[model samples]
Target: MNRTLEIELIDELIALKSARGLFLEEDIGHAPVERYASDDQFDTELELVFRRRPHLAAHVSELAKPGDFLRVDLAGRPVLVTRGKDGVARAFLNVCRHRGAQLVGENAGCQNRFTCPYHAWTYASSGELISAPHFASGFPDADKTQFGLTAMPTYEALGFVWVVPSPDSSLGAPFDFKNYFAPIAAEVSELDLADHVQVANDRISVAANWKIIVEGGIEAYHFKIAHRDTIAPFFEDNLSSFRSLGAHMRSIIPRVSLARLGDSPRDGWRLRDHANTLYSLFPTAQFLVQQDHVVLIVANPLAADHTELRIATLVPKSEAGDSELWMRNHAITRTTLDEDFALGESIQRGLTSGANAKLTFGRFEGALTAFNQSVADTIAAVS
Candidate 1:
């Protein structure tokens, strides 16, 4: 973050601590419960949001060398992302030109060529159809160029690879990656995220609406009640603040020990020392910046009440040897999130039960309100 914003956040934290209160919105916000339970709404979101947005595929570190590749499933399409010999990262449909068989099934690997097990149709790491067994008599006039994998527009920024599922007609225009990320680009750039090595990457299926999972991360109003046995003791009760970064949001939840910073000189007060900053990266990802490491939580919506949640732990390259410490950190975070996801599941069941017509967001849950508003506004504008 910039110096000015850092100081301002520090001031806000100190004042909120003194007042024993949290940042609040002007009024309560309401969202219909049907939005989470309707199959039609979920299908629309999958078509309008997931298929058109620039979804994060993998970090550059995951594809550090040429010929390195990773397979990711996005919006029901298996995407193959590879760093070619030319040192450019590219994405393509992970399917063969013939017979529609999946070309590569491994989660990740390093290889110069991929040969389809079904037909022996081979392709280079650069996505070129180099060879096909027995094409002489069966199909002598086959064009190698025309039989290559379907390509998807891929870009590397902030040390991550992002792919748009239908790039040509996404949002009815060319997706402007730079402009879309302008709000939080400089802040993320300052973190040198590319330099960090991913320590762990895992996924879990959650029985809850995607929005419920996302909403769980952007506010601290429920921490004291929802996480009483796990993380509640460490954090202050309902004490947090947030700011909207374009359509995305950034939130800060201070540790209960922040009051001790009052004894230290203001010059020595570091933001990370007293709080954790969580960045909600628009539609699919959340980045939690802690003192020693960063955690990325990605939500992939599978249905109106199902989501695949992927969590990744990233740490500085220098700390790669400290497996014990990183493991402990990862375990704690995972446990806390498991608690949150459980709550989301219960909430989803309630929504499905049709007991409530709408859900209410209080003043303290301003971050949730902002996030819901952003989603609504974006979908409305696109529709």
Candidate 2:
């Protein structure tokens, strides 16, 4: 972060600490329960929001080598992202061109050429068709160029690879990845995220709407009550602050120890030392920056009521070999997040029960309100 913004955030933290209060909205916000329970609404979101936007697919470290690759399912489409010999990261539809067989069954690996299992057709890491068996006699006039894997728009920045899920979408004309993320680009760059290596990556299927899972990360209103036995002891009671960055948001939840900074000089204050900064990256990614490590939570919507939560714990490269420390941090973070997901599941069940027509977000839950509104506005504009 720049010095100006750094000082500004510190001032906000000190003010909140002095007032012993949390950030508040002008009034309460209400969202229809149908947003979370209706299948039609879910389908619309998948088409207009998730598919059309650029999603953070993998960290650069995951594909550090020239031939490294990672396979992921984005908005129900199988995607294979690879680092080619030229050291460029690219994405393609993970399906064989011959018989439409799913290619690259493993989650990740290093390979220069991938051969189809059924037809034995092969492709280069750059997504070019390399060879096909019996080409001399069968379809001799066929154009191999047309048979290559379908490519998706991919951009690598800040040590991360982002891909547009739709194969037909252009990365330049309609959507510019750098411009779309300009608001928080500096903040993310300052963290040196590219220098951190992922120490642990885990996925959990949650029985809840994806939005519910995302909303749980942007507010601290439930820190004390919902996390009473887990993380509540370390944080202040509902003390947090949030700022909107385009459609995205950045929130800070201060630790109880932040009170000690009240007596310290402003020149010596460090925000990360006393608070956890969480960045909600528009559609689905939540990045939590802690004192020693960073946690990225991505909510992959499988259905209206099912979500796959991919959690990656990234630690500084210097500490990558500290297995014991990283494991301890990962375990604690996972347990805390598991509690939030459980509550989200419970909330989903209640929404399905038809007990209420709408859900209300209180003044202190301004982050949640803003997030839902962003989603609604984006979908509305596109639909």
Candidate 3:
């Protein structure tokens, strides 16, 4: 850890020890207050958090290579990320330089060239404007060089692709992901996420602000009440939540011992006695790291009251070959996510009733408070 973070961590540790299950007044009251979801000012905040952040997107090892490509929505714009013939990753606005049509509609695939659906405008993996439907006709002034797809700024590190929508955006700004995550990158790096591959993925839309849904995953305070049937039996009421870079939070739930049950043995199942780790990366990414696998939830907010949550289950390359574990984990993952989203959507409907203006964060919920505070700071700074 850096000296600055070390000092902050020391203070946090001291506070944690002294308060046990409460937050300091300064940590809560001193925090800035603002609406992140319904407000128009930070409309793109979720997008920046998901796609532009270096540490968050640094989960891919390579981008450009023979037949390598990925498609992602950068905020509302369609983005096509491709590895060129020269083995360099490049990102282009998915719109064809001709007539503003989407170049690639599929989620992801390896393609040597992209062909527009409306016209036959095609582009190479390098995003070079290659061929147009008809030439030497009505439009002789068209320049292929100038018509190449709008390329976005991209960089690859730690195995993921990071993109900046504004090509000329400042790289040294405070919100620059690398700077924002400098303090906690080591902690995140310890997970060795780059070593894992996506085993399964599923998505669902919920009626809730992105942050409201994120709040569901960041604190264990609700596990006892909301997930009593599923997660409560496995965790202790006393949970530890840590605030890290970019207003991200990690929740640690010490596991319970089930071996005491009549016929249960502690042999192979002893691993369950370890802690359950939950990580919520800004602005709305949730990751749960278990002994065997890592589950990532990329929450994309579409409206003030609607969010799309994508769940990706990742496993070690070796374990990915196991069909039985994949099947079992997939089912468990789906059921758990549905349970969370069901509640989150319900809360969204409730929050709009004017019955609740501000929600209080219990001492155990300090991480959520810290995350909201960070959002407030970012919005204020941007303004």
What lDDT does each candidate get? 0.87, 0.88, 0.64
Query: TM-score for all predictions?
Result: 0.94, 0.96, 0.80
Tens digit per residue, CA lDDT, model 2, 228-335: 989999998887888989988999888988888878887887889888999888898888999989999987899999999889999888879988889899999999
lDDT of 3 by residue, 208-310 (tens): 7777777777666666677777767776554544655556666555454422322453233332235556766666566787768888888666777777777
Over 4 Å off in model 2, which ranges?
169-174
Worst 10 residues of 2 by lDDT: 167-176
Between candidates 1 and 3, name the one with more favorable TM-score: 1
- In candidate 1, how many Å is residue 250 off? 0.8
Compared with the true structure, what per-residue lDDT tens digits does model 1 show for residues 1-383?
98779878878977888987779889998889978889998988888777777788999898999999999988768899999999999888898998899999999999989999998999998889999988777788877798888778788898799887663523456678898888998888777789998888889999999999999988888999999989899898888999999988889989987777888877887888789999888889888999888999988888999999899899988887898889888999999999999999999989957678999999989888899888888788677
lDDT of 1 at 50: 79
How many clashes in each candidate?
0, 0, 6
Q: List the residue pairs that clash in candidate 1.
A: none
Best by lDDT: 2
